[model samples]
Target chain A: MKIVITASGEGLDADMDSRFGRAKNFIIFDTETKEVSALDNSVNLNAAQGAGIQAASNAAETGAEVLISGHCGPKAFRVLKEAGIRVYNTEAKTVRQALDLFLQDKLVESSGSDVEGHW
Target chain B: MTIAFASGKGGTGKTTFSVAFALSADDNVTFLDCDVEEPDSHFFIKPEITGNEKITVPVPVVDSGKCTGCGRCAKVCRFNAITMLGKKPLIFHELCHSCGGCSIACPEKAVSEIQIGTGVISSGIRDHISFYQGLLDIGNTKSPPLIKAVKKKGDGASLVIIDSPPGTSCPMVTALKGADYTVLVTEPAPFALNDLKIAVETVRILGIPFGVVINKSDHPFPQTEEYCRKEAIPVLLKVPEKRAAAEGYSSGESIIKIFPGLGDEIKKAISTIKKEAVR
Candidate 1:
């Protein structure tokens, strides 16, 4: 299974980003192959509006089965759930630790968005 | 002729002076409170609303039966108001700018537009003044559409006084877009002067004939006056601050009642604006 972790930098050692919509980068991890690839999310940072919706679409397009971020917004959560992707809300200090927690089943799947979408 | 009153700084007497101008005018003047978010001029005008209607914006609605799951509609939306998941697009109307891009991008003609009410525009009369105002629904983010509707209500009036919202952004531009003249209300204070410079830049960019109205001018802040003089902008009116006027404003009385002498000053300001707008 592929898992996506929102990160502040491009790699396993980068800090886990607190925000999911305007996150700086995404670190995709392939559990079976132990492969790591970075997806830059800088384009959505200054988006005039609906950054969460665009970010959700981007995360789903990466073919990740699960997304791990500190917080998820309502609109983004709906999109991910519709795309058959599950989000795990966490405050893990770094991407490496988040992956470990996910493997150990220490992260809880978010039933709904923890934050409201900004208009 | 249409004249808009705007102050980049909030609470600098934009509504006060504009309402005063409309009341002092000898002819039947239309008053539009384009500050849909707050719409405070209605408190001053006390208009007897004769007509009111909801204003709406068009947002995309996808036809699930006709959609091809191609995600073209989602791709074409600049505002990301539409997002496709599992071959279906979810429309977020709040984020929609009503550009109709998704409808245009649909290949199978699955996308259609629907109207969602964002606010209400009202029109009526207060004596010789024809009054109009837009009241944005609480928690609704779309205001430009409502402001436009309010402005439309005052169309064809010989004299129109538009009280625009503060800040030089979309709302302000919508109000001042085609005005014959703009009165940039300001005060001789630090924060007011800072915003006044930006407001001046906005009007200059729009190429609208504009003058400054310095409220609370008795203050010793000579910087505002000096800046206007150096820029060659006309100081249309200098209304000294008065406690009596403030008391009258709180009680919802016409400003002319508090300061009877102000009627002549408003008349003079109108003449100067007419002369400048003509050129």
Candidate 2:
């Protein structure tokens, strides 16, 4: 299953990038296949804002099953879920840990409300 | 015609220009402040609210009995506002945008729509200006919903002035959406110059013709004029920096009253904007 995770390298085994709309990097990884790669987040200026959605969509298009992130805004959260992608909400967990949690079915899916950077 | 005063950056005198210009021209003009998050325009134009209407956004409501743990609703929701766990669906109101897609996609028809109060749109009346303002309820996340309600109060007359919020976001878009003209209020500082560019971009994006009005013209920033000229942005009027003028604003008094010539200046600005808009 394809998956996306919002991970902080320090605490969460995840990709590292500058602030959304401000960052220019995306570190992608596949825990099950142990594959890792990086995609440029600076595709375009306007796309900076729509990055989360783009990343999620790209992941889904690649047949990824889940996306994990430290936090997701309401708009991006909606976009990812609407794309038939499952979302795993985590706090300060490494990307690997989050992926592990999801693999173990221990990751909690958000009923929204915990997403940040809205309004 | 309505004139909306806006700037992408805050503290750029959106309220000052909006209220002053409204009071200067139409004695009976309606002033609407669509900046529900921080509505400071009322401080200058004090009007008693005559009417108010609650604004609500639709959110998802799940019926536990009907839900079959199918997770279909959760899968359809783009906002992740709904999640299925162990034959139950959890619905979060704040994350919902009221799109109703989840309800439509729900195979079990268990997901229904509910109203979430976002804010209130109020109508107030002073001596002449009919005041329509939106007050986003505390803790409410959205301001566009309330701004839409405020814009509805424009009765299309000699003058309808709107004081918009200080950002290039949805609320600002809503405030300036249908205005015949937009008056961008800014200072003569670097911050003002940068934000004015953003505000200009926003206005242009909305296809609205706008002019720049330097609030504190006497300030030492020479870039305001240079920037406007470079961008081909019109500078309608320059209000020289004056202590008495600042005092009036500080005391919540209209600048036109303190400086009688301001009324004429604002009137001219409106005419220039209209002529340019039609041209």
Candidate 3:
């Protein structure tokens, strides 16, 4: 299964980006293959508005089955849900730790957006 | 000629001067209160609202059956008003600028436009003077479109006076666009002078001939006059600070009626604007 994590930097060791829309990078890790890839997201960091919508489309197009982030806004959550991507939040400090928690069945799926749009 | 009265600072007496000028014009006069956020010229003109017309702008809707889920519409929308998720498109109406890019970008012709009311225009006549006012709906951030609707009523009138909203932003620019002359009304104060400088730069950039009207001229702010002189900006009128002007405004009366001799001053200012604007 491919898991997409919003990260502050490259690789699984990077910190988990709290902002879903303005994250620095999206790290995709394949659990079966143990392969990792990074998608640069600097274009949306300075967006005047609607960064979440653009970021959601970018994440959905990646064909990732699951999304892991510290926080998600309503617009991004809606896009993820419609794309059949279940969202999960973890209190883990790093992307690698969050992935580990998922494997251990410790991370719970988000039922709805935790914050309003523009948050 | 179309004369727009604009100011960068709010409550700088843009409406007061615009209303007085409209009343002073002997030719067919149309008063457009373009400050949709807080239109107040109607209080002074006291026009009998003949009727109201709803103003609508086009927003895109999708045909579910025809949609190909190509995501082209979302890509074309710059406002983030539309986005696609697994072939489903979500529309956020408030963020939409009604640019119609989505409908034009749809390859399958699945997108169509629907009219949505943003505001209303009230039209009436106070004796021989025509009056038009735009009242925007609460929570609606769109005012330019509403201002356009109100400004259209002045098309055939001999003289059109637009009372623009405060600030040198989109609302003020929209109201002042295409005017033959713009009267930048300001008071003798620091904040008003600061905003007036910006307002002057905006009109200069737009290439609209403009002059300054110093309201409350009795105040001891010499820097404003000095700045205007250094910039070579024409000082058309200086209305002395009068207690009656404030008292009359509170009672919804124009200074032209409350203060004697002010009517002729406005008339002279109009002639000067006509000379400066060159038709």
Candidate 4:
């Protein structure tokens, strides 16, 4: 299945590169075939408030079936849901750890979010 | 008459101007603070909310007895708000937008809809100015619902000044929509200029007539004037970069009270906007 992961680019490390809205890129991965591609989280050539939806929608247009992010805002969540994508919040990590967790089925997919105060 | 004060970025004096304009009107007006995420206008106006209404939206609640372990709800849900693990579909109410598509998409007809509280819209009065504001519930995703409730508090006769949230996003869009005219507030700085350009584009796209009000105008920046001249957008008013004014704001004093001419300027602005709104 097609999937999108919001990652803090800590250079493929276990620690999250940064907080939400500060992620370096949204990495779109494939579960069935294990392929991966990424889109920059930066909007307007700079970090913006909540680029998750734009990133996810771009991924969905490429047939993303799932979205993995550190956290997401309501606007992004609404758009992703309407696009028929599943959202999962994973452990804080770099892009690679997130994808690895997803491939190993170790990532616990959650509908409830720990993200708050997202504008 | 409702005049909306909106900025593309925060700390551009939306609340400061709205409160000042309302205080200066010298009439029993209402100041509606639509910034639910951080409704700070109340801090300056010091209005105590007298009435409040909860804002709730419908969200899907799965009835496992009827779910049948099928992943249709999960598959159909676009937000990943519902997931089937083992034999039950887990519902995340916070993430749900209450679109009801999931209930309709479920062949088993197992999912039901329920109300989830996101925030509250409240009404209050401070001296000559009546106040209505929306306070978003922590952990809630939706804000426009609360904004709509706050908008309903206006009586349509009294002068209604709206203190809109920062940014050119959905919340700002909802608050600014249907306003007679919006006062684009900004600073004379590079960051302010960039954000104001975006704000101008947003208002223009929405087909609303807007003019610029340069707050802290005396700041050491000429780009604001240069940009306005280039864009041909009118400069409605200019409040100099005065530290005393900043002190008054922090100390909760309305600008019209300290600076008498502000009320006159705002009245002029209202007249101008009224004339433009008719066209």
Candidate 5:
């Protein structure tokens, strides 16, 4: 299973970014092979609006089944759920810690968006 | 001639000047309240509304049967209003700008445009002035379309007066567009002077001729006058601040009626604007 974690940097030691839509980078990790890759999300960072929906589209295009982020907005959550991607809300310190939490099944799956649309 | 009254700061007396000017101007004047978020010209004009129409914008509606989810609509949407998830296009109405790009880009012609109400434009008459105002729906952020709709009603009037929204953003620009002249209202405070400079820059960029109207002129502030002189911008009128005038304004009374000689000053300003507009 592929898992996408919102992060501020590319390395495993980099802190997990709390913002989902405007995160600096998204780290994609494969649970079986443990292969990691980084996708830049700077385009949506300065967007005047609709950053969440654009970020959700980026996540969907990545073919990741799971999303681990500190927060998810309403529009992004709806799009991810429709794409059959399960979203987990987490406050893990680092990207590696968030991956471990997901592997241990300790992360809480969000039933709906934890934040408002624009937040 | 269309005259737009604009200010960079709110509560700087744009509506007050607009209402008073419309009342004092010739009989064939049209007053357009372009401040859709808070249409307050009616408070002073008290127009008897004769017509009201809903202002709408086109939003894409997807037909699932014809949609193959090729992601064409998603690709064409600059606003990110459409996203394809599992062979289905999800439409976010709030983010839609009614550009119709999605429908045009759709290969299967599955995307259809549907109109959604964003506000209402009402037309009426108060004495000799024909009044039109746009009222934006609560929580609706699209205001330029409604402002355009209100301005459309001013075509036949001999003189059009637009009460523009505060700030130098899109709505204010929409109000100032195609205006023959602009009357910038501001106070003599520091913040007002700062914002007035911004407003002046905006009008200058649009290449519209504008003059300053200093409200609350009784307050002793030399900075505003000095700035106007340095910029070579004409000071069309200066309305003195009075407790009785403020009290009358709060109670929806026309300041022209309360202050006897003020009407002549407004008329003189109009003639000056007309002369400047020709130059």
Candidate 6:
């Protein structure tokens, strides 16, 4: 399964970005092969409006089945749910740590959006 | 000729001067309160509203039955108002600017326009003066359309006075555009003087002739006065700060009504504006 993590920098050692929509980069990791790739999200980082919806579309386009971020807004959550993407929230930890928690089934999956639409 | 009262800084007495000037003008004058966000001139004018119309903007509505969600609408939207989620498109109305580009870009003929009210434009009469004002709904960010609706009512009046919203932004430009002349009202302070320079630049760029009216002129800030002299911009009027005037203003009374002698000064200012406008 492909999992996308919101990250502030490249590689698994990068810190997790708290903001899902305005994160500086998105790291896509394959659970089986452990292959990792970085997707630049700077375009939506400074958007005047609708950054969450745009970011959700970008994540969905990657065909990732799951998303791991520090937080997710209502609009982005709705969009991701429509795309059949499961979202999980985590603390301010490194991408590799979040992946380990998810692999151990210790990460809490979000039932509903944890933040407001424009957050 | 249309005269707009503008100020780059908020609470710089744009509405005060506009209401006072409208009241002091002849009976055929028309007052357009273009500050849709907070139309306060209605408090002083007390126009008997005869007509009210809703101001709307077009937003795209998707027909789910025919929509393939090809993502064309989402791709064409510069505002990011549309996004294709799975096989459907979600439209964010707040971010929509009613540009109609998304509707046109929809290949499935599934997009249609629906009008949503952002504000209201009301027209009425105060004595013999025709009064119009636009009131933007709280939380609505689209104000330029409502400002345009207010300005549309000023076409046939012998004299049109527009009370512009404060700031040198798009809303202020919408209010000040196409006016024969503009009267920039500012207080005598460093902050106000700084904003006044920006306002002056805006009008000058628009190629509109404008003069300055220093409200609370007795506050002993000479830098504003010096700036006006250096730029050769006419000082149309200087309304001295008076306790009675401030009290009356808070009670929704005009300056001319509070101090009847100021009527002469307003009259002189009007004449000066007319002469400058013609030149």
Tell me the RMSD of model 4 versus the true structure: 7.8
Evaluating just chain A, the predictions reach TM-scores of: 0.96, 0.64, 0.96, 0.70, 0.97, 0.96
**Alpha-carbon deviation at B21 in model 4, angstroms:** 1.3
Residue B259 displacement (Å), model 2:
2.5
3 against 4, candidate with superior lDDT: 3
The collision pairs in model 6 are none
| TM-score (second chain) of model 4 | 0.92
Which lDDT values do the candidates have, in the order given?
A: 0.90, 0.72, 0.90, 0.75, 0.91, 0.91
Which residue pairs clash in candidate 1? none
Model 1: CA > 4 A from native:
none
Which digits, one per residue and each the tens of the lDDT, describe model 6 over residues A20-40?
A: 999999999998888999999
The CA lDDT at B212 in model 6 is 96
Q: B1-279 in candidate 2: lDDT tens per residue?
A: 778898877887788888888777745688888889978778888888788788888888888888777878767776656655335565667666677988898888988887879998878888888888899999776688778878888865666788998888877898889888888989999888888888898898888888898988889989989998998989998987778878988888878877768899888887787697732
- Over the stretch B1-279, how does candidate 1's per-residue lDDT look in tens digits? 999999999999999999999998888999999999999898888999999888888888888899898989888888788887767788888788899888888889999988988998888898999898999999887688888888887778889999999999999988888888999999999999999999999998898999999999999999999999999989999988899989989988767788877988898889888889943
DockQ of 3: 0.47
- TM-score, every prediction: 0.95, 0.72, 0.83, 0.71, 0.93, 0.91
Docking class of 4: incorrect
DockQ of all candidate complexes: 0.73, 0.07, 0.47, 0.08, 0.66, 0.67
Error of 4 at B85 (Å): 2.7
Q: Count of backbone clashes for each model?
A: 0, 18, 0, 5, 0, 0
Q: Is candidate 1 or candidate 2 better by TM-score?
A: 1
Off by over 4 Å in 5: none
Better of 2 and 5 by lDDT: 5
The CA-based lDDT of model 4 is what? 0.75
Q: Is 1 or 4 the stronger prediction by lDDT?
A: 1
Model 3 reproduces a share of the real contacts of 0.50
